[model samples]
Each structure stands twice: as structure tokens, then as C-alpha cells.
Target: MTITTDKFNTEKAPKPVGLYPHARKVGNLLFLSGVGPRQAGTTKIPGVDLDEHGKIASYDIEAQCRSVFDNVRTILEASGASWMDLVDVTVFLTNMDDDFAIYNKVYAEYFADNQPCRTTVEINKLPTPIAIELKCIAALSE
Candidate 1:
């Protein structure tokens, strides 16, 4: 059987920093690209303060967590999926030691109802100034 593939991008979500769609579907799985906390239609990143060098000075992981989750939900819905469809999630944090507990706490609030397989790792940095990003996979019910 031929494999069916489709890509999705939504204007309501933050425009991707690179040349890639927000999410892609191959068969029954929907894969989301790294979603960050940057708000749509603006450069403001929630809870991030930039130094004079345009680098991150201080960031509240809790705020980023909520914003990123909202972005992910936006992409999922735009792609005809829902938050409950997420089956696996991979989180990337620039500073795990300082942010893990806060991020985990905020994450629990959003994911209280849906328990998906999750993995979180500390990374050196991301392409943007945000502190966290999420790469997720969802199993569409349809």
C-alpha cells in the first residue's frame, strides 16, 4: 500500500523559524516540529528577558511551559487532532537543573487528564531565545 503523507501549518500559531511545517502526518501518526513559547504575530516570548547582547538573561520555565503547550495544542487542532491524541512527547530544555521542577509542575497542570509517554532532556541551546521546546507525536483517532 502507498504511504499517505501530509504537512500542516496554521497562521494562528507562531510561524516556524525555519523552512518547515508545524506538523506532518504519515498514516495515523502526526509529528510536530519543535514548538517554542514565542507568541504569534509578535516577537515577544513569554517570561523571557533578553540581555543587551540579545541573549537570554532570565526566563521563567513555568511561563514558557504554558505558552509552548498552548502552541502545541494550536497545531494539533489545526491539524485536525486534539491534545488527547498525543501519545508521546519529547521535551527539550536549555537548563534542566534550574527549570525541570518548574517545567514539570506546569506540565502536570496541562496534562493532568492525559497521560502520555514523555521524555525530557537538557539541551545546550535552541535556535531561539526560549528555554523549552517540545517535539510530540499524536495518534489520530480518525
Candidate 2:
């Protein structure tokens, strides 16, 4: 495999619906694709498994946000990396004003000391009306 292709592999991150890989690794760097609150294969948010009635059984922003982190972690693990390798991150939110606290709560749990360069922004819309999306870059070990 090419250097970039080997560093980041689509199979590592969540499946992309368009012309995008979950992440791409180039040399010693790993660039993760933007991740939202969706479950592995479905557009539905992670903590909410809807029934046939389309009614959500449970939906917590904190839970959903943590799930997003979990997805990121999965990608990192796939690339033989981890959150400690993260160098930069960008968070996109559909409703930042409403979800900031919940996002922070979940985020702090995962990023407490291994804080990577990060930014957050309020966007007009997200892929699935999920509260947040995260993309990151990580430096691989030599």
C-alpha cells in the first residue's frame, strides 16, 4: 500500500456515503474523516434506537457525543493510533448554543489531558441533524 493509503484506511473509520474515506493516513500522519453521532451503518444517532413507530426510546446529547468520540477512537485504533496521538481536531455543531455544555461534558471525559489542538463552530446543518461532528488529525509513532 502507498504511504498515505496505509496510514489511513477507510475500513478503519465509519463507512462513508459519498466520495470520502473515514480517514487517510499519510506518512506519519492520520487524518480522520468527519464523524457524527450516527451508529456504525445507520443514520440514526448512536444512543437512540428507534422502533417501527419512529419514536426514539432514549436520546441524550451526552451519550450521543460520547458515541462520536467512541467512533473516533475506533478509527484511531484501526490505524494503530489513539487519542494520545491526536494533534488537531475540529468540531462542528448544528446547534452549538444548545449543545455546547453537553458536548463539553462528553468531550472532557475523553480529552481531559491529551488535549489536542481543537476548535468548535456552529454550523447551519449537519449530516443527520446530529448535534455534533468531529474530524481530527493524529501523528503516528515512529
Candidate 3:
């Protein structure tokens, strides 16, 4: 069978920083790109304060995680999916040790019932100052 794909974008989510769409659908699966905390059409990142040199001066992991998940939700909805439809999520964090607990708490509030399979890992840096990002996939509703 030939597979067809479609790119998904929405104004409710932050504009992609590079040459990629927010998500893509191939048949029933929606694959989302890394979703971050930056607000749509603005440079503001919810959980981060930047220094003069654009470094993270202070950060709140919970805020960042919430924003990222909200952004992901936007894309998912735009792609005809929902949080409950999500089957897998891959999370990236710059400081996992210090941030995991808060992130997990906020995450539980969203996914406690639907509880998708998840994998989280520490990374050196992301494209922005935000502390967390999520790459997710969902099975599209029939």
C-alpha cells in the first residue's frame, strides 16, 4: 500500500524555529516535532528569564513543561488528534535531575488518565532557553 503524508501547522502553537512543520500525518499516526515553551508569534518563553547574553538566568520547570504540553496539544488538535489519542511521547530536558519531579507532576495532571507511553532524557541544550520540549505521536481518531 502507498502511504500518504500531510504536514500540519497552526497559529495557536509557536512557529517552528526551522524548516519543519509542527506535525505530520501518515495514515493514522501523527508525528509531532519538538514542541517548546515559546508562545505563538512572540519570543516570550513562559518559564525562563534570559540574561543579557541570552542565557537562562532563572527557570521554572513546571511552567516550561506546561507550556510545551499546551503547545503539543495545539498541534495535536490541529492534526485531528487529542491528548487521549497520544500513544507515545519523547521528552527532552536540559537538566533532568533538577527538573524531572516538577515536570512529572505537571505531566501527570495532563496524562494521568490516558497515560501514554513516555521516554524522557537529559540533553545538553535545545534550540531555545526553554527547559523542556516534547516530541509526541498519536493515533488519529477514525
Ten residues in a row with the worst lDDT in model 1? 55-64
Candidate 2 structure quality by residue, lDDT tens digits, 1-142? 6453663454434576567777787888888888876777656576665667765554577877888898899888887888899999999976677788888887888899899998999888665546678989999887
Candidate 2: how many backbone clashes? 2
Q: Model-by-model lDDT, in order?
A: 0.94, 0.78, 0.91
The alpha-carbon lDDT assigned to residue 92 of candidate 2 equals 90
* Model 2 ranges with Cα > 4 A deviation: 1-4, 7-13, 47-59
Q: Who wins the lDDT comparison?
A: 1
Task: Provide the lowest-lDDT 10-residue window in model 2.
Answer: 4-13
TM-score of 2: 0.82
The residue-by-residue lDDT of candidate 3 on 11-56, one tens digit each, is 9999999999999999999999999989999999997889999999
Alpha-carbon error at 63 in model 2, in Å? Answer: 1.8
Q: What is the lDDT, from 0 to 100, of the residue 97 in candidate 3? A: 85
Question: All candidates: CA RMSD in angstroms?
Answer: 0.8, 3.5, 0.9
How does residue 35 of candidate 2 score in lDDT?
82
lDDT of 1 by residue, 71-129 (tens): 99999999999999999999999999999999999999999999899999999999999
